[model samples]
Target: MISLRNVTLRRGTKVLLDAASVTVNPGEKVGLVGRNGAGKSSLFALLAGNLHEDGGEFLLPPSWRLAQVAQDMPETEDSATDFVIAGDSRLMAAEAEVKAAEAAGDGERMAYAYTALHDAGAHDAQARAQALILGLGFKTTELNHPVNSFSGGWRMRLQLARALMCPSDLLLLDEPTNHLDLDALVWLESWLKRYEGTMIVISHDREFLDAVTNVTLHIDVGRLTRYGGNYSTFEETRAQQLELQQAAYDKQQEKIAHLTSFITRFKAKATKAKQAQSRVKALERMEKLAPVLASAEFTFEFKEPANLPNPMLVLGDVDCGYAPAEDAAAGAMPTVIVRKATHTVSAGQRIGILGANGQGKSTLVKTIARTLAPLSGIVTEGKGLSIGYFAQQELDVLRPQDNPLEHMVRLAKEALPEGESGREQDLRTYLGAFNFSGDMVKQAVGTMSGGEKARLVLAMLVWQRPNLLLLDEPTNHLDLATREALSVALNEFEGTVMLVSHDRALLRAVCDEFWLVSRGSLAPFDGDLDDYQQFLLDEAKRVREAIKESQKEARAAAAPVLAPAARKSSSNLKALQRDLGKLEQQMLELQTQKNAMEARLSTLSDPQEIGELGLKMQTIDESLADIEDRWLAISEEIEALSS
Candidate 1:
């Protein structure tokens, strides 16, 4: 359990929390939420022991192990799998002990080290790390890729994977989904819900908070408030409280005003002087009720498109992928991810791109954005077409050395379409609409936070007055208010929209249709996100089966043939056969249990019930893994005897 009673927390001279109190029991999943500077991360810091309360009681058990994602970007040449495995500090420590024991030739210590290592899950450490890697959307072959080979966003994902790899009593995740795709995000939500430890996560994603957390902790105006339910329930409960508080405050104000008026009218008369004095004393002793003040919200909208083109663009047998390398040897082939894709995007059509990671969703978007030229096909554009593309890595397009003002100036020089303002003051005003004002406009872009940079890009996008908007993962850095604002803007925008986002709320709110990119093809998916999630799970199960089949084949091929006169081993083979059958039956039962739990999970709105289901599913997965291994061992024994 963790408790903060009458706690005062501060950063410099400013108080972030004043006598705040919160209590969390073991195994509770808490969603910590607030505005950008509302002390959510500060609270996380206190939990992580980097900060202490300025006053009052803060209690967390000393024996509880803590795990948190490292904020600093990792720089390492180690393979991704190795990097993730190292996050298991207990395993690392046990391995170190083994190494020292061996070096010193200490038999007793060596025996103890081996026992500790086994207890720390040394045999399955790699498998555990790889499972996390694959769940987070990494391909099997990429497990051996060096950490430094990935981009910054990918590196951050690795960092998240590392944090999840570690076993802990308490886990802290700050914006864990920022770099994740929908598939990865779903996997992570499932993992966190199944986690036996207490978790405190700071995320602006409402759906994520609703899915994983059972408790909501909101910070506002130097106050911390805890709610019993998830974010949605918290919002409902808070709205009712605000209404009640406002009514009470209004009633209190009326009484105070009436008393003051009577005192003013009668204080000079000898008959009423004593009564007025008593009224003044009563007023002085009364506790003033504070009025309900809503938190400040930021919102912006897209300007109406200059012109609406009915058919925004048409792709004819387009090969959406990278072209052949210019410096490659003669007759080199181009790598095509989405082959012979044909589609027509029309005016005011809100299209959502849906696919598992590495399914060429980004490749398709890049082709439309003109970041990558289509290979061997024509992309016919509408006569008055204009596009505002927000790439997954759009920030890379911004010049880090330049300020926001300079970036806008450069954009104006390159693409200041008619009727759009290109004046310096006009650009500054536009930036201000997105919360960049005064010194912020002139400040270096490199020095700003990710959310600020995202806002700057959005401001620039709106400035274009584009009739076609291409947004990929746009809500990654946006807070709830900004995400809602974007959803509203997209809903009202008089333009064609194509979005690829992990944020389910944004997807449901904005997209009227979904296009799926899978297995080197593109097609319309006649289903919602829920159906897609089930599809993903089914697909994953099939993949696992295929892998198991391939491994069985490999083991058979590698096994040494026994003597021709192996009739004596018939009884041994029969025993192995019985064991294999039992293992197979166990696996079938576990898988059945997993499937039923998953079905229940889809329909369950209660976080606690979902969490329970998740835990059951995890146990079933481990049991299946164990059964499969034993099943394979039995099969091998039979094969060796028969071959």
Candidate 2:
């Protein structure tokens, strides 16, 4: 659907893309992978026709329609659903025209309206729209809520849903999964798997790329290379290729050294002069292989303080939730969201918080960090409990007006020992470890992207050298490469870590125990996320089978009691029996629908999709209400006979 032929893009003096060519076939999912500032977003812009390339051509079929999830959406007074529905403006406009024509009572115009409506599938549009809304995860109530109330992260989801709703031949998604929770990510993966059109996604999520994409297109050093297969496969192949290149470069160097030595020794000898001259000519003509740059080394070494307590932080019978100070006079409680969960964090304990969205993960983190008070719970701090809390939304603490160097200098002054020499040098060294080196340290934090800000926060936290670290969604904005670096750092740290993250891969890599926050309760899992997921699935299956078996037995037990009444008073008995049968049928259908809805909900992974499913399940609840009403009437009738 889209192809780039010898494309070269330059931003000022920097060559972002140099003679890069790539072909994306229809219905293919391609992952665009590279380091930060490697021009992944720039490439997307070029293909999206939003940016003009300096050289070569970007080709697309004439009929191909392209849609991109815009980085920044225009401010509007619309609701989340309203924003999404706006994406179908063309269809809406056509419908409006049709309505106007119908109102005018013009036969010719009305006929045209009819044709347009039929062609556009106007009759089925409502159903499709509802399905899409539900699939993206918006509660029916939330669908009408104003978009202005949503955070920037939620706004991004709205944009993604709108992009998905558009009828396009090619979709270019940049960091599409950044704001998505685990459920939403999974749902998006499933949707992309079944997507009929082409997709070129720019993501730092390794698992997401591996699950959704069939091809990997890497951009590095103003060049592009395509590998056939998923992200893991691409990594393996890329590593092998790099190894081969290094070996070849090494062999060439050895040959050149040997030839240079021979030339130096035989320069004055008449017989060997000709051989020396030939070697010199060969050396001059040899194409020098580009030297490979080593990956940035990130080492996090913390000196453990003596006299540390067994429990770093403790919460006993604690209630944790967000409470607005302004609403305190309105008799607003702390929500008591996390109820009396006696939790302990000790040295060397790596805990991972696992749950659905809005389950009070962030609230719990705040309570442990002592940023918020827990209502009616004993929250005690252990001796020498030096805590470094990294809030999910706390990147705002970094002054945008200050450059990286200024921030680093301030942090160093505040965090370093009283008389430590080379403080500025230490700040430089710390920033360098986080990939901010030389001139980059001079860039304003205001101009930095979300990923960069996240890295900076981590770097700052490491510099503090706290014994207890409280991190919330640390991996949210991080790219794959940076996330790996963090994972390595976290694993090597000797201090205690309590983290709430949606990244399963990172959790598995770093966490030792799982803390599940579900239904206002915090339950500790002695295993990983994968194990917890498996346990949930197994429990759900058991519940389903139990419900089915109980229903079957109930029906069988009622059959014999109704058989004799049918023979004695035929008409009346038949009427009663029919009513009972209808009730049972209604109950069965409702139960079946509930099961199906639950199964569908289980299949959904995206937050939006889960939200949509919740809305759908709400609609199905009406059917459940009807079933319950009938079931109650039938139960009363059945009980009368037993009396």
Best by lDDT: 1
What C-alpha lDDT values do all the predictions have?
A: 0.81, 0.70
TM-score of 2: 0.74
Candidate 2 accuracy as lDDT: 0.70
User: Candidate 2: misplaced stretches above 4 Å?
Assistant: 103-109, 118-140, 245-308, 327-330, 416-422, 531-643
Which window of 10 residues has the lowest lDDT sum in candidate 2? 285-294
Give the clashing residue pairs of candidate 1, or none.
none
Clashes of each: 0, 13
Where model 1 places Cα greater than 4 Å from the true spot, the runs are: 241-296, 417-421, 561-643
Candidate 1 lDDT by residue in tens digits, 159-230: 998999898999999999998988888889889889999999999788899999999998988888899999
Q: Residues 1-643, candidate 2, lDDT per residue (tens digit)?
A: 5778899998779999999998888889999988778899888877777789899998879878777887785577786666776665456766787679657755445445544554665545555554455444454456667778777877778888888877778888998877776645655776788888889998878778888999999998999989999987887676546546666466446545755776798778874454355446444422231111123223233344443566787789888876667846777655677888798777667788876556678888888888888876798888888888899787888999888878878776676688653467777877887778988898989889888888788877776778887888887777766676566456545577788776766676667678888779998876766676565555445644775667656653554354434334333644656766776787688778778866776565665555555555546666766555545445544555545
TM-score of each: 0.81, 0.74
Query: CA lDDT of 104 in candidate 1?
Result: 79
